[model samples]
Target: MNVHLGKTPVGLDGIAAAETVLSHVDGQQGELIIAGARVADLAAASGFEGVTARLWSAATTRSISEAEVRASLGLARQRAFARLPELLAATSGLTIVDGFRAGIAALRPEAGLDDEAAIVGACPVIAGALVQRARGSEPVAPDPDTSHAADTLRMVRGDTPDRGEVAALDTYLVTVSDHGMNASTFAARVVASTQADLFAAITAGYCALTGPLHGGAPEPVLEMLNAIGTRDNIRPWVDAALARGERLMGFGHRIYRVRDPRADVLKSAIERLAGGGADLPFASEVEAYIRTALRQKNPDRVLDTNVEFFTAILLDALRIPRQAFTPIFAVARAAGWTAHAREQQRTGRLIRPSSAYIGPRP
Candidate 1:
């Protein structure tokens, strides 16, 4: 049996090709390219709306305006809500992944047809369901006039978010839009390769993210913060965590050799909403202490702060309920899932990986 699958001949890693347009992840150097540009360079030049538009345009021939994205997502939110009661009943007592899978099955599009509008649109719908579930409330209707970010905030909070909160949510979505071939995106591509429809593929991706290793970090990230109780307790908390063998929730990544760029990007957004002065300073102190202690204890696995660290921070700042963090991740990630699904379909090959089959040869 081969220990690792040989590098895929057709799939390009670390290098950019023309099929999909969005950020490219240079895992080795920890760099991201958005629409034929680096994230840092793009950061100084563009806002969330521009990057999202550029990514969507690159994949689809249709020209979908931001207004259209808003309208479609708004519609999807209502549609998803209408289905929620049944979904909630069906998914009772199940794990979130199982429940989400139930929701996906319940919400799967009729017929064999694929609709980009529906696929791009289902993001906030799924997000709304997960958010409402977390809050112990029934799903709410989506507002058509609002932007995707703003409407999501409204749906979750039952009121429109202030400008700062909306801006922060926009930045969060943009920051998480794509991250090379992280676990969930990889799961999405694998399912898409089998020619699964967009919803199925995205459902598979959501399952991957529901695991603790990926999208689950954000919930614990905030818990860690709350456990510290006060600013002064942060260092001791870090020390105690180090003394035990617990890995810090949000402080590392597989691809990023340096810092995760998404962390800094979302941190900027959090600063805007959370008044990034004293709290941010406290966060910085906690991060620094964790880094030093981890390095001292285990030099090889450095475990620097990753995206989840500040993801929790920004979401908390936006007054988003803690339980909904992973669901929000799924919503933002749906865009990339849809885009990738379309890309896989264009390639038109079924994804089939062969196993070694070492058990008792026939």
Candidate 2:
């Protein structure tokens, strides 16, 4: 039995692909390419909204205007908001998984029947689950007049989002649009293997993503920066972290040895938001300082920064509230997850990979 699946067989080093544009992850080089260019270069060249259109086209083989996607998402968000009380009420006194279960149970069965509309419809349900959980309040109505990115900002912040802020959020959405078969994507596909609804599969995915090692890392990345306080103490903070055997949360990735492509794209967005006066300098500085220190400490650890750093930074700039970060991730990633789930379902094979038992067994 293989321990790690080693290095992807069949020459497919990354996730399984049904269609491809440019999202490539070279773990050896720590590089990520998006739409025929490096992630960094893509970030520099396009706004997040543009990237969303690009990814959606690649996935669907149909051209969808940003406005169209936004309109659809806005409508979906509105519907999710209307049903929020039920979702939130069911979530009370329940664990995250229980809450997810309750919400999935509450959602109608058609939501997972494999149509574009239903697939898009699940976006807000997944997002609203997280939003309500984070806010400690029931979810609000999603606005149809707003863009998907803008509505997300509005739902979380309880206010209209400025254009620049909306642009930043859209970039975040686009940057994370899809990443091949990540953990959560696989979780979704596994649940779908049972012919479960989109809500069920995505809820399963969200549960997988809720771990600190995954979607939960970004929110804490900000918290870590805040704890570190200032740039002056970055080395001590990181050194102390290493000393204590605490693995740095946002500083590295399982893939991408040089740097995570998404990080560069998001970093560019962060700088733009900062230029528009978002005041995320302290967080940015600490991240930069930490990266430099880590590289110096063990040049061989080859620990370059990854998406979580800028994920925290970008969400912070968008005024998305720390608690909402993971959910926001769920919203954008649901697109990729559903797309992959559909592709997996088409293959008609249960994702029942055999695990090697290492311990005493029957």
Best by TM-score: 1
lDDT string, candidate 1, 250-329, tens digits: 88786676788778887777667656222777677778888888788878865778889988888877777666677788
> lDDT (0-100) at residue 282 of candidate 1?
69
TM-score for each prediction?
0.84, 0.81
lDDT of each: 0.69, 0.66
Q: Report the Cα lDDT for residue 322, model 2.
A: 68
* Candidate 2 CA-lDDT value: 0.66
Q: Roughly what TM-score does model 2 have, to 2 decimal places? A: 0.81
Q: Which stretches of candidate 1 lie over 4 Å from their true place?
A: 1-21, 40-50, 61-64, 82-89, 92-98, 110-114, 133-138, 274-278, 357-362
